[model samples]
Target chain A: MTARPFHRSQAEMLPERAAPVTTAGVVGWLRANLFSSWANTAFTLIALYLLWLIVPAIADWAYFNADTAGDDRFACKSSGACWAWVDQRIGQFLYGFYAPDQTWRVDLAVVLLIPALAPLLFEGVPFARQLRWFSLAYPVVATFLLVGGIGLEGIPTDKFGGFMLNLTVGLAGIVLSLPIGILLALGRRSRLPIIRILCVGFIEIVRGVPLITLLFVSNIILPIFLPPDVTVDSLIRVIVMVTAFASAYMAEVIRGGLQAIPRGQYEAAQALGLRYWQSMVLIILPQALKISIPGIVNTFIGLFKDTTLVIIIGLFDILGIGNAMVSNPDWLGLATEAYVFIAFFFFIACFSMSRYSIHLEKRLDTERRD
Target chain B: MARNASARRPGSPGWQRLWSDERTRGLIYQLLVILGVALFVAFIVSNTIANLQRAGLASGFGFLFDQAFFDINQRLIDYTSTSTFGRALVVGLLNTVLVSAMGIVAATAIGFVAGVLRLSPNFLLSRLVGAYVEITRNVPVLLQIIFWWVVLSGLPKVRDSLALGDAVFLNNRGVRLPAPLFESGFEWVLAAALAGVVATVFVARWSRRRQNESGERFPVFWSGLALIVGLPALVYWIAGSPVAWDIPKPTRFNFRGGFNVTPELVALWIALSTYTGAFISEIVRAGILSVSKGQTEAAGALGLRPGQTMWLVVIPQAMRVIIPPLTSQYLNLTKNSSLAIAIGYQDLVSIGGTILNQSGQALEVVGIWMVVYLSLSLLTSMFMNWYNRRIALVER
Candidate 1:
């Protein structure tokens, strides 16, 4: 037998076998995900067909034949989207009634925000320790840029009413409401009878009513409760109402996160001799906040969308601007294009935030698993 | 020795110390918060009064009794330009309720069908449903409403309106369908029809209990349907079929005599239902998916058919998950019904807006809106909570 093996035939000298592709590999993935069954195959085909129909039409209307370079409606007659309306009103849409020359200030404010926001969003980045101070500084810087105080000609709040105004309302509400919301959440869970009841009542009442009603009340009823000599700007009233509405929702979301945390964690903090506030700030909040990030982002998206209701109160957010455009004689019957454009703008922002929330959720899940 | 004495002083009463300790500072904090709230409220009231005085506007519900000279395009109750502002508001509220109710029914039906289709074993159907959901949901509802209004406006002129076999007419004005006119003794028939509903509910409960105890299935659905539909028809027949159908006829510029759903109402309804249905569909799909596959497998192993297993085991459980979200969506749809203003549907918000402009009683009008909407929301939530508890799992 050994002699026969030593006489080794070519048949015995085979090459090493290759590995088969996994279900997760490219070709196998396509088969599994897109064509695993007859039903899936049919679904893929139909989806492809529907997409083919829509993609070209959207492209043709939005880009290929769009009047991107036009100054006015007269320049856009290509049987496609007349984006000229957007181009012409872009400034007004951005800064509403803000003086034309003062748009640069708003732009500058946005530029300042990016650097401040970037480090805050990136976990474990340098200056993570400085984030609290940075948060405090942002409002001051943003206020100066927007309100034009201290030798700058003030742009009245009433004049701030468009896409930029929407952003301002949303961001202001988010920033202002968050700390209050956390406190409210804690208060609702507190042993203090009066505080818990008040917090619970506030949250329930606000959450039960629609935001539009709150805005309506702020614009209409809030003034009646004040003294006769005082005056509040419409923009300020809207901001306050939005902040209250958002805080209620945020409180509930944070409360959910708080409830989800293991009781042992709180016990451990108490065992370590941390005071209530200290334990919350150091031990509880970080984990609770991480858990509630998605909820907070969802609230922001809702706030952003709801800012459009300002139009009912006579403020010109993006939706209001679009509504304004439709009545122009030159843009008559062009409602479709204007609505489509605004809808796309809203969709892009909301979708991005939702996707980011999903990513955060996945990351949190991984961390929990580890 | 001094430290030991101080520590032992807690024996005097730890609870009393906790209650009285200045470090806790409960009274001061509570007083501060109350004071802040009161001060803020005082400021707001003063500002409002000043603004109202400056604007030469009076604040009250007095304007509600004033004659509303405006003519609403649609009204559930009889109203003309001579109606009081209060009456106009009532009409508007009814319209809002009407549209919202119709929208909820249509949306739930469409949502359930689409949601199940999205999970269909049939490939094309599922993809189509998925695409519908994604496209509809991703777009802002305001845009969809506007789009529908525009498209409806683009239809052929009223003179050359799109006619469905000379019976139904679609025009810029509205879609006209045949209206039923009740003749003499129709009230008795209506009473009998209502009686049928009461009977059906009783029978359904009894049959359900019977089935539960005996494990014998009853055709409760068909029986309920027959009682509701067939019994009503029988009553109508016994009352000499008192109702007559009035078909709409095209006039020079509009259709006449039949019930017409205005373009504004149609557009609002379609937009709201379709947009809301997309979200509801997702909720439904998620609810179904939440039911563990093991339950289905167990049912199958017990020799139950797929359909029977899904209905008997899965859906009852899935419904508990679905109803809560469904309630939220319903509330959302009701709130979004306010969007009717954008398209000129005379909903509560629109009418309130009109009242605001006409009377400059923005404060009062806004207050009424808050109360109405908040009450509506509270009522819905209470009802849903009760229903949820009734269906909730009773874990042993």
Candidate 2:
């Protein structure tokens, strides 16, 4: 009422203005991410061009022009991939020569792995203590289910082949290698010169040679080293060799973890009058193992991929089975399809395992920060 | 108290002292370990002797001198089917060296490019590079080797080769590239190139000193490149260009005249390099990232351009983090080259495997494999250590 409402004492809020289209929408995101500069725009164009060159061709070959619904090679007529070979041999690829009736046992063993791994891998599983007991007994149960003993009809070792063989060897190696690796790592770090030297020697020798040579040793030389009266199964021999190889690598990884722990932790344990094993078990190992989880997982992935090397020693793993399939007259030219199928299997297995490791690492990082 | 003290002395009950005294306990444990190892060795030795005798296999290096009748498709040296097993092994060793060296070169080039591209500011390029790394690394290398072999062998027949001009040809048999035929005067060109390199090194040192004193920059890199290339060209001109190309000529069933790179070599080379390159790219990315952002900012504050900052501030620091793992990657490539056996690439292990089967000398053959590989590993690490020391940071 004085001069005007313009000079009013009460303030009114103004409406929020919209961000400019150039900086705050889909177009803005494209500009920021792909066309931030002249060089970046050019790169984006080139990348798109390259992807255009590769992606559609692969899709056409793998899907559009591909023939997957076939019982034999002759049923495939596409200029692209012939996946009929993969289709017909899928069972053999998975179970090898495992009896068709006993295939359920292999499937059960594989399914049991999830529950066995759950308590060890995750923090909030129900009845985790009881699950830990199952985790401890998983190897025995898996062995009985797959290999058979104690009321189960036994499957001969030769029947174990294909991807089942890979999973069995890899899982067994991963399970057995950890405790041995821990012992070796401790030995390498031991105050006693003899123990340290022996551990160091074992690790260096194993790591220095190729796994192929070790497999050769297992195939031809291991039997020579053993007593003649005690004939170990070839599968068992391979598992033993693979475990030794992985454990040597695992020892070095664990040693890195052991070294990373602050010296004060050990001193503190000693101050509490804890003996060597007690300090290691109660105070040291948990922290070291947590730090080394990524490395442990990496070693497991490597060992799993390396199970393919058993094919070199003439064991019929998945790759071996794939090779055998491709050589058949019905699938003579289907090597590409066979190899791609096998590669896809490995990629899925390894990629998921690596992702899990990264997840665990992030969790550990958050816990440490807290 | 006196009895307790006396019990702790040297005259105590042996078993009690062994169990109670820490020093004695450690000594006993070590002795036990040694004895156990000795017993294990004795058992293995006794068993091996019996087994070898039963199998009627000769043991020792004696078999190495015997004739290796098997033919190796890819041999680096002059070895026929008539060659001794040792010569065949030497040929295999050379082949291994050839592939490893070539694979190392290609892997380094691919790794550096992929690693830098993975961190590109352009989002799409980075994602593409990331995809390449993930897909290549996760797949089994043996499968990759076999896959590549299949791909290579699936190429068109020699009669239908995909020719690049008259100088290069590609087919199922492999690549046929024009080989340079050096005449008498070519040595002078090589000498000139060597001289240019030596001169360039001196000039670089001189230019660096001049920069320190006068703050005037010399274009050392451009000048060095010009010298290396220009001097060689000049010499070649003066020597009448004593080089000729041996381009491939298509024959009835194959190509001749050019250098024939076998399909097995191509497959092994591509697979090993690509596989190891993925690992190396990851190493390189980690190395580069370990160089902090503050470094670039600090360099910028000091008025260095972005390229200069990368060259002078980032890369030098990053290299220290890179070299150790790079050495390991190199060793891995060398070791993985032994996977040549899977695809019949005629590497040391493949030849050795053949020899092992022929001679039935598993012990000796395995021993040779271990010794040679161990030595190779040791030699590589030693060289890498030297290089690392030369580039190491100097601290007061």
| Per-model DockQ against the true two-chain complex | 0.37, 0.81
Can you write out model 1's per-residue Cα lDDT over A193-271, one digit (the tens) per residue?
Answer: 7788889989888876667677777766665666555678888899898899889888988998999989999999999
Cα lDDT tens digits for candidate 1, B71-101: 9988889999998989988898898889889
- Judge candidate 1 at residue A179 and give its lDDT: 93
Local accuracy by lDDT, each model: 0.83, 0.90
DockQ of 1: 0.37
CA RMSD, predictions in order: 4.7, 2.5
Where in model 1 is the C-alpha error above 4 Å?
A: A1-60, A63-75, A124-136, A151-153, B1-24, B38-63, B118-139, B184-199, B230-243, B360-363
Docking class of 2: high
User: What are the chain A TM-scores for all the models, listed individually?
Assistant: 0.90, 0.95
